[model samples]
Target: MRIGLFPSANYSAKKDIGPMKQMGDSHVISDVLALGKGVAGSQQVLCLDGASILLRKLSLDSISKVEYENNHFCFGVHFLLEGNYSFVSTESKSRLNITSGSYNLVQWPKTNGVEKLKGREYTSIEVFFTQEFLEDLLGTEYNSAFEKFDNTLVDKPKYLWNEMKPIPGRLRLLLLDILHCSYTGIARTNFIESQIRCLLIEVFLGKENGMEQIGGEATLSTLDKEAIDEVVSYIKQNLKRKLTIKELSEVAGFNTTKLKSCFKKVHQTTIFKFITQLRMEKARLLVLEENYTVAQASYEVGYSNPQHFTVAFKKTMGYLPSLLLTNLS
Candidate 1:
């Protein structure tokens, strides 16, 4: 919802023409619709199986704009087909702006924020998944790509990624079909439900086009994600040390089992593997950017035996460490 050229900044939506169509799980609830003075467009919604799909096509007058506050434990994605928006966080004082043809996964536990919109034409689709529904859908899988969501159970909202990504072409077309669905009654409900599942697959597990990581959805609680993130930061800071699972568990305040599961879930790899990855990445940087010798680079990341390090480097990097040295020679 937006506020612009209205009677007052406090203008609340006083009118909801209500239920233009209601059949089975499909409810054509036209809200904030009916081209008013400053704004023009229709806001329709589809609800099914703990998910809500909001489809809006709006056109504002040249001087019109919409400013609305966001306050909820939101876990979903926002797709913008047109217009630009700026979101301001009241708690962190962070600002994010997104242009057309971009989308972002939102796991806002409590976004005490405001979103501003100003454009001649605005179009967007929002898909929201309930915590229970999402968890059920994910089914306790290991190595899910997305991170944690903003949870109502948490005291306050922590870090949420506002990174904007381009909308995949196929997903965009599917969204358009949803916006202009011609099906009615039970068929409409079934169609929308199928589309929702497809949306999830396309955004989070589309191994076909390699868009699985594109949505950047991570599964875990807010606290667990933060704890894991903290552990990762510490690992980065102390890469030269021989970090162990016990030490990381202490750092994360989680037991070994929980720590291992959560870490793998967030990173798509075990803690040890993640550490190896970090070490290999740092060693590569040292060789390529700092011009460190193979031995020096290996030793710098806690590899005492250069031979062992060489084997590991070759296995992880798909090439021998001495090749880098050969290039230098």
Candidate 2:
């Protein structure tokens, strides 16, 4: 069924309205609803399982109105990597503006919308999944994770729209991995599916547990917030240095007790875990993108022993660094 705008009888048939065709397991109909002398470039890839794992990058050369319609019931988590766009619901007239480093969730039965893109390049990654797919991955835990939508009737699809929210650091890193993945064919598809499942679990679990508002509370004083930010910056900048909690505490000007508490409050992770996460992420990028060997990447990320780095990388990323290189090759 045609879900988006129908071709108007008045306009000439020479106009381009983007692409409307079957994509993976779903049908996507996108049209240039309105154009102000702009060009749009987009790349879309669907996983082997059809629309189960979809990634899209879009760039607009000028102001334009884009409309999208989907014929299936699925949930989408969109990460606005760059630029901003305004979305107006065609059915409800509700409006939302999504900016970089933020994400929004939308559920089906509510797919039609008009997107107003500013004259700038914008990149976004959207991962879509059906309820059955989520259930298969999450099992009984799914109900608890998505308790907010528990009342949604299966027989009558409901529109669920979650306005933009700040992207958590862990989820951001995963999205980056997906964006930078080098594998192709079935390997790429498998990697994407695994990452999507992890992403979904993290998002829903964060929502369920109120992890989204990590540092947005009056409990953290301004000084404490500043200190936490400083500590985070230091960790990122000094990934090659062996940073202990005591050093980090001094860097933040907070005592050990206060340092741990404030760091957890601000980053939703302990100082050690947070540093390890950053190190692993950096190491992954180095190995994948910079052509760094496992030992070299480990040392670059502050791992004194290559064996330790290998174990830690495997534990956190679910595979050894060498395996990643082999897959890419």
Candidate 3:
């Protein structure tokens, strides 16, 4: 593998490492650069048995516009993994924005983009399969799973507040197992393929619905759609300020209950959850990218309580904002 260290950053790759395996074990893994202006970061990309997983460590200030290669399907499994990234469509440059606070399975469209990485530190797992490889596995029923995965594309997919729940836990363990097997030098086989099938079954069968199901519906008219959009847009724009449902209701000209239901249908989350996530994302951006103090950043994001924000930050990002800032700095 050719490892390139560019003018802005340094990278090193070797076949032997202490805690991780090198990329390309029956799959392809690339060294990803931390993009966006603000903090220095590192990314670990691993090719598990039949899947690819990326672990990225970063400070809060990293947010960059990134482009990915074609022909891969990825599942974002971490807290806010599904919620925050913007996946740009190569064909039309149309973007699919994954809002914060959800789990996601992303299918990369068959298009290419300029190879520059800028954004927050994040790790993602991807499964790449050629048409032939998929056909062999799908036989006659391949389309079914594909359709279900596609349905999720229309909007974000729900995950329980925590992944330890039965359905999500099993899938996560299965993924981790695949990673272990690949790292330990397991050969690709039907057994490995079957495991993937089982994982997909669990994902498609779960009662977890898409963002559209929770946020918006067909019975709602165009005006209703417009109203919901306005309220959501307001919330997004004012993440730094204090916002209440009563305030949002006035903006949308709908009662609190109607507003809440509308948000669930279009965004797949309660208004309160959406705001909490917005605050979390804001705090993350401030502490990691802007280099704000924990106290300063906490308040800027609407967490009047620093202790509460610290706990929430650690819970969502899997690391303390202070620690992340130290690494990036």
> Which digits, one per residue and each the tens of the lDDT, describe model 3 over residues 27-52?
43334543335645545454434344
Q: What would you estimate as the lDDT of candidate 2?
A: 0.64
64-168 per-residue lDDT for model 1 (tens digits): 433334344546677787777666665677766666656776655444555566677777877766566666766654136354433545433333444555554
The collision pairs in model 2 are 25-50, 25-51
lDDT of 2 by residue, 1-329 (tens): 22212323222244544443543334232232333355555544453232344454455676666565455556666677666767676676666676664676656553456666563656667666667666777788877656666435332223344334545567767887887767655566667777877887787665522434433443676687778768876887898888898998999998899899987765556778777877987888787767898899899998889999989888777777888688457
Which parts of model 3 have CA positions greater than 4 angstroms off?
A: 1-205, 210-219, 311-329
Cα lDDT for residue 140, candidate 1: 59
Candidate lDDT values, in order = 0.64, 0.64, 0.50
Give the Cα error of residue 314 in candidate 3, in Å: 6.2
Worst 10 residues of 3 by lDDT: 2-11
For all predicted structures, in order, the TM-scores are: 0.51, 0.57, 0.47
Q: With candidate 3 superimposed using the best TM-score fit, by how many Å does residue 60's alpha carbon deviate from the native?
A: 19
Candidate 1's C-alpha runs over 4 A off are 1-26, 33-35, 63-72, 89-93, 111-113, 140-143, 147-162, 208-329
Error at 232, model 3, angstroms: 2.6
- Candidate 2 has a TM-score of 0.57
